[model samples]
Target: MARNVNYGALICCLFVTSIFLGIFVLVPVLVALFAYPSSPSFSIDLFDNQALNMTRTDDSPTNLTIHFDLKLKNENKAIGLHYPDPQIITFSYFPNVSLLTILAEYKLDGFYQGNGKTRHVQGMVVATGFPTVLEGTDMIAFWVDLVGSYKYKKDRTKMHRVELGCLVGIDYISSKKMQSGFIGLVEPGLDSKLKKKPSPDYGYP
Candidate 1:
């Protein structure tokens, strides 16, 4: 005689297992997909500058700064962020000839954000180095950029990642005020020659 196979019991066991997996694993992934975190927003004000101006005095090496207010907002009501050590923040200088490669100018600082709250982080990236002047001119033109990458946990449940980037530009390195009173070597009637080639600025204010 063949033993009876309990098909009803096997079906019930499968249904129970599926329910547990759905509740424990699949639900969290779905929530993370919908309630994802937003990229960090930044609004910065340079210390002792009227606007986003880059300046160097006659004697001092060019002081490059990346300090500004950095903010992160958690869009997920259930997600919280954990910022561990070894956060990488860099401020680098791009030459006029090539803006791709850079000489690192300053260090960027990183921080953490809470659920439904905006985290405010502040620091100053000061780089003191002699700037190279452009050929046939007493002025220097270079670009400054800031990049930050951070690792965080989702609702303290799992890990996720995000990044932040910004660009800064040095219009001119002269203390001499133009006739318009801007911080550059903009002399009257010589505007065409003094003007450098146009470059894309990312509104890094």
Candidate 2:
């Protein structure tokens, strides 16, 4: 009887151990799958008007506040964004005066501020490292000020089309997989268009 009892107990222990091992291995796969699982499509939304007041009267430094309603959903989960680092938000404007592509970058930290505000953030971007999660929902509102400028196409004299947009990445492979959302257009202005110049090969960064 004693020997039989020992054998039974051994079987029970093995069963339990197998179950535990299976769970442990499965957990990591589940977490990784959550990180960036496959899906039919993903999208982000931008509000109609600019949230914070943007002033570019002088070249000292200007803050361009942007308010956005961002949402992301996958096959099984919804994700929210929390940016601890500087995320790049790009604006492309073709002025009626310049024939060059005028690109502006706004770096920012974002949050969900109320009163139609996601959070009281400061910078030219809403947030970085977006879609930080796989199954959650968050309301994000932030601002971006024109802190500085970089010449993308140079020749700031010819007329061209100006469109506002952004550049985003996921899975650490930036530029390669970028999420760009079109915001608006820039009418005839100082930084009108791209000069007769050759633009960079790919729109990544």
Candidate 3:
């Protein structure tokens, strides 16, 4: 009789342990396997100092041609991104504390980005109508907005739209024609709803 009782207790303990493992360990692993990956990262690079200088010919408006490299990195460990063709990029300038003026729009050819990989896309845009406030200023700040749709390589049937934005400011000395590199912070997250305007904390006054 004592031997049978001991066997019954052992069976009960095993059942309880199995339940605990299922609730604590197996459940999370399964949830992670099906969840979406982390959002991708983005940055911009301005290699040429002259890219920011405005030029004019005859009666033509002040032409500001900017050459930049847009960098996109997939942060996922196992998932990849499929960006559709013709991504739209908008360049704008601030005429005042509350006014944003559109300068130019450029379209970039899209491609695939593998997990844990980065891609540098070369882009250029010719913008006119620079605000008088930029004249003789030591620093100029502008807004860069990117809008595109992408699909997960793991699930290509569904396409998701993403909007990314950042503010780039450069300092220059008009006497020497020298300029500092571009610096800005790309907003976090993967959609337009997650984007926030630059505040005083980000050097936007």
Candidate 4:
């Protein structure tokens, strides 16, 4: 009789443990899977790569104009996206192995995007006082960083910010001109630290 009582107590303890585990672990997992929104896709297109060139002379600064299109897509099925005004787009060059130099920067205007929709933002950035010398290199690499804040349609109370970055190498046929054509867009890597950072005050509720 005592053996049977011990067995029944053990079964009760196991059942209670299972209930607590489901409430604490399984419930949150299900909520996260259904509530979290998907990340958007980002890409950049260089319109005139030939514009990327260096000017000769020390007194006269080089003015490098880069015309490009930034493509942003909302991949979420039901949730819309609200981008804040004046998105920051930076163009940088790696003059050496470790150093990164900013050549140009442009403020892109923000807009709303429906679910599964893509936006093509056309803009240009002129780099003045450019210090890089591209005379000896056949190809030069540039890094693009995009930083912006956004909010989902369902969750307007919380704002989420993200940074997308990519690198592209331009091949120069001459010191003054780059190979003519549209440079293929490279998919940027999303910053992993995006979730940990605090959201900015956008005055949105």
- What TM-score fits each model? 0.46, 0.27, 0.62, 0.61
lDDT of 3 by residue, 24-44 (tens): 997776566447566677666
Write model 1 residue lDDT over 3-66, tens digit each, in one string: 9989999999999999998899978887775565554344333232335444545765454444
What lDDT score belongs to each candidate, Candidate 1 first?
0.45, 0.32, 0.63, 0.65
What tens-digit string does per-residue lDDT give for candidate 2 at 1-205?
3444688889999999999999999888877555543321222333333432222234623333234433322233333232223434443322222332323444544332111112322223432222211122121212111221211122332222222323222222221222345222222222322342222432544
TM-score of 1: 0.46
Please identify model 4 stretches exceeding 4 Å from their true place.
1-34, 48-61, 131-137, 174-205
Report each candidate's C-alpha RMSD, comma-separated, in the order given.
13.9, 17.7, 9.3, 11.8
Candidate 2: list runs displaced more than 4 Å.
Answer: 1-17, 20-24, 27-44, 47-85, 95-105, 110-205
Of 1 and 2, which scores higher on lDDT? 1
Off by over 4 Å in 3: 1-34, 47-61, 134-138, 172-185, 188-205
- List clashing residue pairs in candidate 1: none
Q: Model 4 scores what on Cα lDDT?
A: 0.65
* TM-score-superior candidate, 1 or 2: 1
Q: Put down candidate 4 lDDT per residue, 45-108, tens digits, no spaces.
A: 7644434444355665456677788778888866788886667877776555455666667787
